[model samples]
Target: MTEPDDAVPLRRRTAHALDLMAFSLADVRDGLGPFLSIYLLVTHHWDQASIGFVMALGGIAGVIVQTPVGALVDKTTAKRALVIAGAVGVAVAALAMPLLPGFYTIAFLQAVTGIAGSIFSPALAAITLGIVGPRLFSRRVGRNESFRHAGTAWAAVVAGGLAYYFGPVVVFWLLAVMAALSVVATLRVPGDAIDDDVARGMDKATSGQHRGPSGFGVLLHNRRLMIFAVVVFAFHLANAAMLPLVGQKLALHNKEVGTALMSACIVAAQVVMVPVAYLVGAKTDSWGRKPIFLVGFAVLTVRAFLYPLSDNSYWLVGVQLLDGVGAGIFGALFPLVVQDVTHGTGRFNVSLGAITSAWGVGASLSNFVAGGIVVAAGYSVAFMSLGAIAALGFALYLIAMPETATGTDSGPGVFALPHRRQVQRDAVVGGELVEDLDGKV
Candidate 1:
């Protein structure tokens, strides 16, 4: 969409900003590996073990670089640049996969892609939090997830169609196109609209101003943040491998429609996720984070148990809708919680990265264990075991996790600062600022 010659209203401008963000998110998501298992299994004739090993490489790369990249996001003003680079790198890496020769080469390439792609999450979180601040973050993030899941849903449908006609390799081209659009959308997000201090998770309006700690240090010592990271890790460990395994299960029974079914599974989950994300955004402020997040874990647990009860593609997919419930809430609330916990520390991005690194560890391990278990005992046992793990995670969250809304005791102390109540913003007309208040433009 082109800009108007006349000054744009604030509402329209806000919508534009969100649309750009949605496009950017959609692009980055393209490179993430939902289809990799299908590609390895159908294209390369790889076994479950090999597919799991290869997929785990990306998770390993994230674990290695997530914290450092997050700290860099906190320190750098090039948040948008990080997102662009990650998007482009992922697209290029994905497109090059078919041309790559060996398993080791592909794994290494995936790892490289992981390194490049790790930049997007923390940077995007930083950008959004900076633009909206803590007060509006929950709702904005919900909208972000809605757009993001919508992108994922759209990508799955398009990729499924392309793969149905031209083979899975065609999916790569679709990603490349999406990546290009993502770059444009990213560029559309106004650079000047971002408040750097606020984005870094600090507000100068607060009294007793002081640099407390680096993001790494603060996140390390924060008990709730660390525990939350552990909870996320456990959740991802169980959640990540279930979809791929479902694809494998379908392939075993119905090789002809396997790819199509896998895509359908993704679309179904993402479609549900879009609405669930909006629901979380609308309710998190009023209802609080722990209950919402715990619901996600509980759904995952139930979904895991349900997977083994049916070999029917429709039944398997219906079970995956349960995933939408868990994933949607977690997606919107994860960074929001992080922002709340680290609100005033200027380590919001880095802290998010730290926790994501933990998530990476579990996600990577999920593939490995799921593969081994499927080979050893069978799919039913594998599903049940994963379900049990998810149940444990839910138990942990229910017992230990505290409510983390702004006024809650477990939330960050920054909101309690006196200056927070007095902060105000200046209005802008067109690209020109109408006023500036204490460096807020």
Candidate 2:
């Protein structure tokens, strides 16, 4: 086990505080997002098909920035400042929505929101690495993701209630206020809690100079990484198809029935994650990431196919249970895949950004593609289609990927290059890796 050395205590306390801050912003953002489709329709009179299409288009358009955003974040000294400003921008853009002229303007604004969100995730991932290292990163991701998922669950109640009570305009105002507060809170926390001397050291050891192909091009170079990205995208596409349409099918039995069912299902799945994270934390590197991910894909595909067969809401909870198992695997392993590829590159944050942005792209495609299908065919077709995608994920992982978790790589890492081509280098941390880095290799 790696000892605390000089940085552990400082990082531990700071990580705890940042966890809370992340939970706060994530919570409100989740709340705003759940009701956004409904809000656009009810308040703005967008048709269901049109609303879904706009949401997908907005996500892709906005994330266009993500393709190159990682390079900028990796090379910049102003990461924290940029993050703080971005948080504030989220609030400002959200708040300004009520003042925007029309539906087209709202769609345009949706794209902008995606840009802000894209900046936040990878930057946050890098900061987490700096503070926690990969030692406890799973737990951190679990805690943050749970809050985010939970926020989405309850955000519906908040946004819908606010929209009904005060109007849709009130919803934007409330979300804006929460996001702005996140900015203030983030500023109060010391940036170096996660970025102290270790980052300075990391800068020396790896390509902190910010040289790389475009984010998309980087994806082209790594077959294993590309496969992982596709798996994640497949998972999200399955989700995009399920979450929106499943609710509608359930609601045909009763009004807003789908919302309650989906929320209940997601929350129950989320509740298992933190404990799973902690349990998986000690062994993630040794037990390997691929088998777990493959198993998850298989189980989730079964769950997807079975969901439509059960009409009872209580029975539906069982489907979510299976999904929870898959989610537990996904939440733990996906980051490991990204970190593995970018682990020694001094490009941890940017790599994470690129991978996550790929995830977002999956979400956009799934949402739009499924929405179009639902318009033409129906919900039965969508769920069945998700099952098919899950199968694809399972097959791809089985064929193309290998376990790259630190302790599992068998090459002696003897001929590794930090970037595209192998190059001369000494110790991984420039002279020597920290004890933890040494332990991994």
Candidate 3:
């Protein structure tokens, strides 16, 4: 077992992990997703249907491996290796993608990339939980989201500027460079800092329940997880294709600035996400997950409705700011809720993978469904339909999803203001601070 070097402070270690997580996002996660659609449409001259089909290949691959990847992360001690390998694999795949000829060849390549990238989320989450444990998980994850969104926003600026001058193919090269940095960041994390027991969600606070190697059947028994999974599916179905379609629309109207406009859209949302993510991270424990998450869904519902009202670039950019509000909450709370639901089952990663698989399917098909509607009807109708779908999800969540918050156990509420003479004790174990439910140092 690797022991955290006693000399290194836990705060610095947390920062290293955050850097790894952030670069991981910048390297390949959401960077390639929206850009790929634009690339196919612009370079290959592919129609909406063809673009959707190609995009779906990756989603299909993710659906197939999501569960297995989670199970592997749970079972393996080489979680860091998994993350590094995933980053390298995604980078290599993206670099090779533009060179591949024919639709099927590219589709097959994207599928492989999808499978490799699938390991990242579970591995990263498990690593964070292991390093920080649940006590600090909420706030750290918020920081992670902030970094992730910052990376995305940065990527939008770089990729947008490069693609504008050099051409869209430049994005693949950018991804390769970012991927190298992510690998370096991952290496900075001390292997010994990870607590395998806590990482697996089997810490003392949660070890009371007896858990075994429950297979996929475990999902069948958790009605709440099942319902939430469906809700996630619905949420993504409405959420995924909007940005890409908006980019395509802009390209149709003004090819020269379309790419930049798309980047602006991403920048707008992600910049907003930085603060919102931080707030969610800092406040989630105090306010409860249900209310915050409901607000996210509601914001998305409104954002979707507002999209069809205007195609003006500035108007669309303003509307996309709402994406920040919704995405920030979802980013911070999604995993928190997952941890709450699977508190001590020892299958946290696998369960999360199951829900992610559902979400992946919705995200994958969103392009197809929305693209078909756009091709047949119009952008307004498609946006309105997505809005209606988001509204349904918001309603379902409000009606069915339970409050997952169980506020601080020992301290005054996490939201409480600081008072003089309060004695703060740091919960440090093995050179790292382990916070209790109470928000002590």
Candidate 4:
């Protein structure tokens, strides 16, 4: 079960390359982020409704393409090329934004950016799986997420400073620079180093004689996967709107420092995520996935309730720090869980994509739902409502979701069920029930 060429210099080089790829693509993947809204409203005199519409269009485009893009990643052998193309596409779209600030043109570019940006997650996960294999994937993903969060914090600081001096337009140029670095990092991941079969979740020893991927229906039939997806949807539904709601409250309370406060919230959460992600990666194998994942849900619930308890800026930011704990665990463990459930089925990326699409839907609705609650009642009610949703997600995970970490001889942790060992043993591959000989299911 060891990685091929584990001792070789090429293996070491590809590992380092993956790290750089994750770091550089951190900024490139999200495009201009909040800068898009700022630029359109401040520079172009666009109305709030119009800005929301354009942003929604891009989000919808990304959501619609997520599953299909994942299927493409699962099927394609040219993973490196796909990563390169996606990075270049995002950069091109972002670099064109300043030139074409018209409503329709910006809408189209945003859609382009969204579609291109969707490729990174599945592709990167596939490449990591391909290079390290499942035995080492948890640690590798942890490292990848750590670098990603660090890269985000770095980009935020650089973008904030540059934007302060030159204006919002400077963010676009910064995106292009990151994208170029991403392209170089991607190229450095030697194509030959990636085992295409392993990348898609096929057992490397058996891959030579393996059939193609299972039918898409197999995903729908997976009970654990379906439950996990529901929990993910609920988690995002509650988690996504909290930060934005906090920012609005800050802005209303203190107009002079609203933006600065929002930035502090973001940077604080990201900084905490760096260490949390590393901890999750390092401990997931020994601790098992269920307990660690429950901690994420539990923390989110606490964070939501805490937000309503205090309106003081310092207290709110302190409450926001809990976001790092929740998000860091979720980000690092997401792929590991997906790989665990879909192992030996050869649909890892597509499963990841489908679940991510569910996540996108939840996140998209969160803002709308939270905003309506705020208008109807108040920020306190909205925060409490979100907290309730988070509690539901936590309950779901605690009661039903099984441990996904494999090869653990140790007893289940306090949160894990005694019957956790009875994971589904048969996966449908190309319309046949293939027994999971590795017992990974």
Candidate 5:
């Protein structure tokens, strides 16, 4: 709906700012994947394999919890508040890291943070979709992804230096500060924003589409969704596991260089994400979302196979780009899928929580599994195996899933996600955002 009083929607720049601020917080913890395991090894004497297990738990929590959290987002009109609260939760959790008694303690704390992060993710994604509409959505999403990566790329230095000097706890302290800023930025989202997609979601739930779990049972009966969840679960297992290994591998060669490079790879990906997001996003929206995903996972398949093949510093940059493509494929679309599937804001948020919790589970599993794999199979075999796993998922998506974002996408998948209302807004088209408004932006 155009605000006749106002000439047009707010400049797309506003959306860019919000995504940058929000993602910065996540980069400190996640982007610094290189340091997390080392910290565990040094502080707790946990060993590589054990640290992997802890990280896997964190990933699982992120996935499982996000599912339910997505449900909550669908049920409410308070998308902005949910993101703000989640940011604060992340910050607080980061701050508490220094207090954990052991690896287990840190793992548990991470799980809590993962759960909280679930709410943060879907809400932020939903809000972005709501505000940006379809216009240049692919571009916007790409920009946001790049900014988040930029934070990680830059933070690589800080994470490595701190780990070298003061230990991992100092990095955690920095994370705390970033999280606080994330919360503050999240709150900066306008209170008056509205979208057609979100409006419809609230309308439907209030009407009577809610399932058995109050907010949790919406997808229990859907066979397709269950398969998607399982597949994603498998995919995240590798993702979560590989990250820590990256840190360990780099650290094994040169601790500081590894840490810095870990961040560097991500930063490199961030730098490239802009053009990729824009170009690929449009294609994703234009063609079937399946084909685009196929391409991304195909790249991942190569990445996994290639990573173990070389220890060369230059090649890691290439790996990050390819891996980033795989990451972007799912990262940008999954929340849109959750937004598409749920019936209400309450259910939406909860579903997100579930997804995040699943990530924690997968990551934790990967942590243990990857550490062992690295030790036995070596990084080459491990990375290759993980890529193969991603490829398997790509094949599955192609065979089973249909186009969910086509009729509804605003433009090509490329959309500019602006925080301002003068821009686009979320308008729930179908029973779900995954199927409905998850178009371009």
Candidate 6:
């Protein structure tokens, strides 16, 4: 009765499938991303204010659905199906954008895309956890992010080149292709490889207890998780608006070359993210999550201030390069931290959803506030304001957030679960189930 997850060959194949899935879903998850702003601004002649409102619509919708979607991932074993459905939803909503093009229609579609896109984060994390188990999760997450960034970099290059020749409309077709590939990748991951119990943070020790997921109150009472959520919210609040603002500024300066310039900005950051993600993944276990995460917040703070210092495209794009360090760390560490905090709660995905929803609130407001500021004052003021928020988040994280890595003095000792490695060792000795500290197997 060897589990599929324990089979080395199947696990290797599953890991490869996860890599392909991450790469393909990279483009599908965000829908049109900043391209939506560029398209609306340059093609449809929409003002920044209206474009921001439309963009915010999606984030707002995602905030509303993320928690519920996370709970759904926890409850269902159909993880692959959820990924497929989400990919289809994002692809269809984005591809339809060119045809509808109207304000309300685009807003409605963006909302749909947001709701669909929310499924990927929790589902993918759950699958990764279920397959690799907790001991290897940090490196696995790093590998996943690396592939995701590479996928984004590739998409930016292709989209930039095509849009340069064929106009922004080509991005829609590109999403369609990526979405199809994502579905293929999702199908390739053997569903049996996922351990339903492990996927939601249940371990063999507690499996026979038949205890259900801890109530949401457990998450609400976690002081550290709440603090982490606030920090992340601030990060997104400052981080989200900067890039789109740069894209808009570039568009304003040179409308004909806006898409290409935006692509350059994205490609630069994503290329940096690929390696940064791998580094964070490799070092997170040994170097710990806090110090690495602090670097991200610090880098973001610096990047924001630097953006307003220059209007030159190269300067702007170079400033964008710092995004790789900041966003790369956040991407790699976010899940690991949440997993650390909610280790035995059977609420990992749901808690992740809750925090991400908070992040969504910050991001949703970012576009609106930055847009209004740009309209009332200018891009420089908007960039500086976002930079200030990033600085505050950095200060808060440096002073208050605790280290969440296991075996650390400040780890989440409240959950009362055995160390992940100990649990694994206990499960495999002599091919017999050994009792854990609680005397349960």
- lDDT (Cα, tens digit) per residue for candidate 1, span 100-155: 83799889878977787788788877777666556656666887888889888888
lDDT of all predictions, in order shown?
Answer: 0.76, 0.60, 0.76, 0.77, 0.58, 0.83
Misplaced by over 4 Å in model 5 are: 1-17, 28-32, 42-44, 99-101, 132-143, 157-170, 195-216, 339-358, 409-441
Each prediction's RMSD over C-alphas, in Å, is: 5.6, 7.0, 5.4, 8.5, 5.7, 5.9
Ten residues in a row with the worst lDDT in model 5?
427-436
Residue by residue across 115-170, what tens digits does model 4's lDDT show?
Answer: 88889999999888776567657777898999998887777777767766777677
Per residue, candidate 3 scores C-alpha lDDT tens digits across 365-417 of 88788888988998888888888989999999989989877653322111101
TM-score of each: 0.89, 0.79, 0.91, 0.84, 0.79, 0.90
| Error at 347, model 1, angstroms | 0.8
Span of ten consecutive residues with least summed lDDT in model 6: 409-418
Clashes of each: 1, 1, 2, 0, 109, 0
lDDT of 6 at 192: 66
Query: Which number leads on lDDT?
Result: 6
In candidate 3, which residue ranges exceed 4 Å CA deviation?
1-11, 205-209, 213-215, 408-437
- Please give, for residues 282-398, the per-residue lDDT of candidate 2 as tens digits: 456667777777778898789778877877777766676676567666766666677777655555555666677777787788878877777788766777898899898789888
Q: Candidate 1 — which residues are off by over 4 angstroms?
A: 1-11, 30-32, 206-209, 408-441
Q: Tens-digit lDDT track for model 5 on 1-441?
A: 444343223222345446656457555335225466666655555766666666666666666656556667766778767766766777777777677656667778777776666665666665665554443344345555555655655566566566566656666777777777676666655545445354323332244543445433645755555555766667776565665666567666765455455656656665665456545555655665667766766776676777776777777666767766777676656655554454343344455555555555666676677778877878877777777777777777778766556344323221223343232343222112222344532
Evaluation by lDDT, superior candidate among 1 and 6? 6
TM-score, prediction 5: 0.79
Off by over 4 Å in 6: 1-8, 208-218, 408-441
**Candidate 4 wrong stretches, greater than 4 Å:** 1-7, 37-53, 98-104, 208-216, 251-260, 374-378, 408-441
